[model samples]
Target: MKILVVFVVMVLFCDCVMTKECTNTPTQLSSHTYRYALLNSKNKTLKQEVLTLSSHDHDHLTPTDDSAWASLLPRKVLKQEDEFSWMMMYRQMKNNNGGSGKVRDSGSFLNEVFLGDVRLDSDSIHGQAQQTNLEYLMLLDGDNLVWSFRKTAGLPTPGVAYGGWESPNQELRGHFVGHYLSATAMMWASTGNDTLKKKMTAVVSALGECQEKMGTGYLSAFPSEFFDRFEAVQPVWAPYYTIHKIMAGLVDQYVFAGNDQALKMVTQMADYFYKRVQNVITKYTIERHWRSLNEETGGMNDVMYRLYTITGNANHLLLAHLFDKPCFLGLLAIKADELSGFHANTHIPIVVGAQRRYEVTGDPLYKEIGTFFMETVNSSHS
Candidate 1:
């Protein structure tokens, strides 16, 4: 999860600014009230009552409320205006003459902004950090990383599996491989290092083989029954969260390193979940059933939203919406300041996904929810 957070922080770095009115607002809940509300929020009966989405209307994705929030925070920060890539391409906006200039495709904002274009100064702290990160990325043993994956596929596991989280007994055994793929992909893109590219390519190839061996769209170091545990609402350590990391890593590989096989693997993974989610929603309300498990889904919504942008598949778009947690987001949809006692790390990624949703769908509700959450977090929680 730390590595996943590192990847998220690297990609979604933004400046948070709050207005005086927002900051001065008395929105903070008392400790007692927070605890009471938190417990009540977890009430299964009450959740089913309010959180269930009975309507299968496609309009659910498009919120009816177009009312603007009172907050004045901006929605996005252009890359050209930022320090990291000041010279990078940006979407053309209106000029001083009130005329819109030639605009770039919103979906391809970073298409031409290759990381290799920027050279880090070796003496700087960022450069040193990059050097350390690059060395660590290269030092990871590919066999050790994929050992559990091979074992799960009935392939001969030649190398000793790493202890701790990567242990074969661990539910999150294959998650690090995803993180490694993302890091190496980004590193190769940034440095134009042939060695890193080759290493990442080999890993992607091995993962592709594993995916084929499993004979399902699923590809993980653990058995598929983990998801069965997830669907059963039994004790399980965040199967979807691990899958999100894997999907996000494959996405990074395809986007950064231009690996077509990575794209195919991730699309298959999405299709697998799309069908799985379809099966689950048929029995019960998506909101109540999925949220009732109280599992950490990581950025499943965000990754799916990303996949939709790439493939433009309607199923991919709908699947992204399926991962949205209405129990929490429904509160934000109504401008409720009820984030107290909610798991911070777990839900923050939901907001990140909301931002991506707004980008892909042009849904005003998503923008409002994302903007309000950011404003609320900056004003009070931070």
Candidate 2:
């Protein structure tokens, strides 16, 4: 009888695991489905809720007055802004005319000005660029681009070597590669340098190959197990911090150098990231592991938001929302100065993410939160 009971218990356990695996699969939304969902009744209700919340007189209202809140209803449609670009410049031209001093012309009030190739054809700028390019070339090796990825995957390190700040012993071993990619891509764009463009392409290709070898859409100098350690509140360096840099670098390459491969790799990595985090972390779990976030995670939220804007992928938008640190942001929302002993660099990225969220979603709460945080930081920390 005891042996029979044991067999039944094992069978039940296996069945439970299988059921969970089946349920964990993410729903794949077709483009048409995504658009339909965006325009559906559910989204309209959400928009109404956002508007009501934004216009609510929170100071005068009591928490128990649900009827009062419901009576406020909703009004106004939100406007969407264009994706931010550094090259796009805008300045408000003051009108000195006698007629009410208000600029009537669309070109007079605020206008976009094109600054044509400021980085090119200037001797001083070219000299500085040449010096920086020389230093970058000295610091990096085209062949060793895959060294860290190889090491993480338990494979052999190939040709040349990573040294200086990106040496294997360094805590930030994988960070410089991302920074290098961004710098090279921007330099190529500014000066139309074929050599720089070629180098950027090679590095991106090598990284893509590394990602393929990992076989899980995961690419990093360290394994995904680091995130497990992070969730467990065990001692580990900032894995997401490193990941943000890599994602940002790839995005820069795609945007500036027009490298499609970089975009593909980043989207793949983002999918893997979303699945892992959604499966592992929940609001309750994140609250429980709040102390783990004391370490820097960089601007994971900011980059994810940018990715969403680029691809219009709901998954990326969801990922961005998930990275919000409620403990910090909650305080900021209430205009509390809770940043007394916080790491300035670590928290600043989160505030910037809030600002980006405001721009993308047109949510006034995010704008308020971001503005409050920025004001507090400028007044206190600055």
Candidate 3:
């Protein structure tokens, strides 16, 4: 009886192994076999389900008719082949247990599932990053950040180093604080580190306090006199350029980190900016004094467009329109090469603004202008 039972167990094990082997048996594909398979598969529902699941966009799937199946099947098979290749590569990566393998075909799914876990193990680059972020955090002083705003508003100055660019006699002063706030906010979001969050909160709160003290919906490291200098075409550094950076930083903080204070500060700043620019500068003035538009304004128009999207305020949209440099955009819209002597970086932002304007207004003219500018730049430069 013991021998029979042992023999029976061995037979059962062999049968199970054979069944597994049979299920996984690989078939050799010839032209005939491939064609036969495609012809034999008549289940439209099953094919539709497979296609629906594989597509990233289900609602707006390409080729929405039954005719798509004929052409789509070959593409679907190719996609499966690509996926299999990636899986084989991923398996090799797992087996090697090293971060040196290359995945040639990466998509949203592959990035999230496989490559997301892949990272350098104790490399010098990562070590330096820790030191760099630490040093950056140490350099940021919240009190000094609001020094200029405080001074202008009759509040006490904390008397720190005034930051790098925020120092006196520097036109670009206070620009660094905006960039720093933006960087810290991003760092906190990426790492979920409480220290970065604390720094961001401190900087934003200080900015808000300065805005309140000024009592004019104005918040800047410099006084509003800079705009007067800008309007007079005198030797004042790019005030709008610096302000755009700060506004963009604040907007980023709000969008990425859900910082409400940052949003409120930028909104108030936008209001002050609109009233000042609208009162002083006109459409005719912009067209006539085209050289004034050549200054490094950063993407002020882009930021205003974004603000309009967030608030649904017509004022923000109007401000965005006002920032359009007609001289630059006008020439580019006609496919003319007016960018010969222009600063590439300065004008690139304006093109970016044009693109944003196109998105917001759905104006084909803005789209044409942006496309022509981009194509011209790429063709000439590259």
Q: Pick the candidate with the highest lDDT.
A: 1
How accurate locally is residue 326 in candidate 3, as Cα lDDT from 0 to 100?
53
User: Can you give the lDDT of residue 254 in candidate 3?
Assistant: 89
lDDT tens digits, residue span 2-86, model 1 = 5445423422342212111112222112122222232244345532432232111111221112212211112342233342221
What order do you get sorting by TM-score, best first? 1, 2, 3
Candidate 1 or 3, higher lDDT?
1
Error of 1 at 83 (Å): 44
lDDT of 3: 0.62
lDDT of 3 by residue, 1-382 (tens): 6544543453354332211001122111111222223223465554344223322111111222233212323453346545455344334422431212211121322223322233333356874685578567756677867677677677788856474356655566777777777677666655566777777787788778888988998877778898876665443556787898889889878876888988998999999988877766564343323334434577888999888778777788777766766555655554556565455555678889988776666555667878888788788865
lDDT of 2 by residue, 307-363 (tens): 877887878877887676555665565456666545555677988987777666655
- In model 3, residue pairs whose N, Cα or C atoms come closer than 3 Å (at least 3 residues apart or on different chains), thus clashing, are 165-173, 166-174
Q: Candidate 1 versus the native: TM-score?
A: 0.71
Model 2 segments more than 4 A misplaced? 1-117, 125-139, 154-156, 282-291
Q: Determine the backbone clash count of candidate 1.
A: 0
Instruction: For model 3, give the 10-residue run with minimal summed lDDT.
Output: 19-28
lDDT of each: 0.67, 0.61, 0.62
Better of 1 and 2 by TM-score: 1
Error of 3 at 221 (Å): 1.3
